[model samples]
Target: MRVLIVDDSKAIFMMVSQMLEEKGHVGIWAEDGVKAVEYLQENSDVDVILLDWNMPNMNGPEFLEKNLTDSFTKTPIIMMTTENKPDYIKKALSLGAVEYIMKPFTNDILFNKFELVDEIA
Candidate 1:
């Protein structure tokens, strides 16, 4: 699986990338939603997106809203963020996110979410 990780923190990206790599998956980093969009425009092979709610230039919700009409809309998105509020999760789902993962998650949690995404997709 090729996962597009949209997060502002390099550390988070590194950690997640390592976790994905352990499972023989590739991780692509995008510092923010703007960059993610740009990357998607050129690469439609992304299997899923692990999006952060807060970021510079563009946020996860903004990205989801913007991509609603784009070709990559078919790509499943999992909102990975510190925002644990039910409202936030609901909003993300309403906007088009297929799943949600709170920050500070373990590798198991991340991969389990991926499995769920796979089932859904």
Candidate 2:
């Protein structure tokens, strides 16, 4: 599986990439949503994408908007964010996120998300 992680924090990206690697999935990184969009323009076939809520240049929601409407890539997105507010989750899902996870998530949750990704694939 090809996983793209978009987060401003280098630490978060590294951790998530390592976790996905342990699960035997190839992972890629982008510092912000704008970078992620650019990467997608050149590369399709991304199996799953986990994006952080806050980022420079373009935020997660902004990316979702552009990705959903401006491009042909309809990659499934999992919102990995520190924002735990219910309204935020609702808004994200409404905007095209497959799921919204709070920042301090566990491997179990990650596995569940992957299972769904598998189903989608």
Question: Against the true structure, whose lDDT is highest?
Answer: 1
Quote the positional error of residue 114 for candidate 2 in Å.
1.6
Which regions of candidate 1 deviate over 4 angstroms?
Answer: none
After aligning candidate 2 to the native by TM-score, how far in Å is the CA of 13 from where it should be?
0.8
Check candidate 1 and list the clashing pairs.
none
Off by over 4 Å in 2: none
lDDT of predicted model 1:
0.92
Tens-place lDDT digits, model 1, residues 29-78: 99999999899888888999999999999998899989887655578999
- Can you give the TM-score per candidate against the true fold? 0.95, 0.92
Clashes within 3 Å, all models in order: 0, 0
The prediction achieving the highest TM-score against the true structure is 1
- Model 2, 30-49: lDDT tens digits are 99998898898899968889
* Residues forming the 10-long window of minimal summed lDDT in candidate 2: 66-75
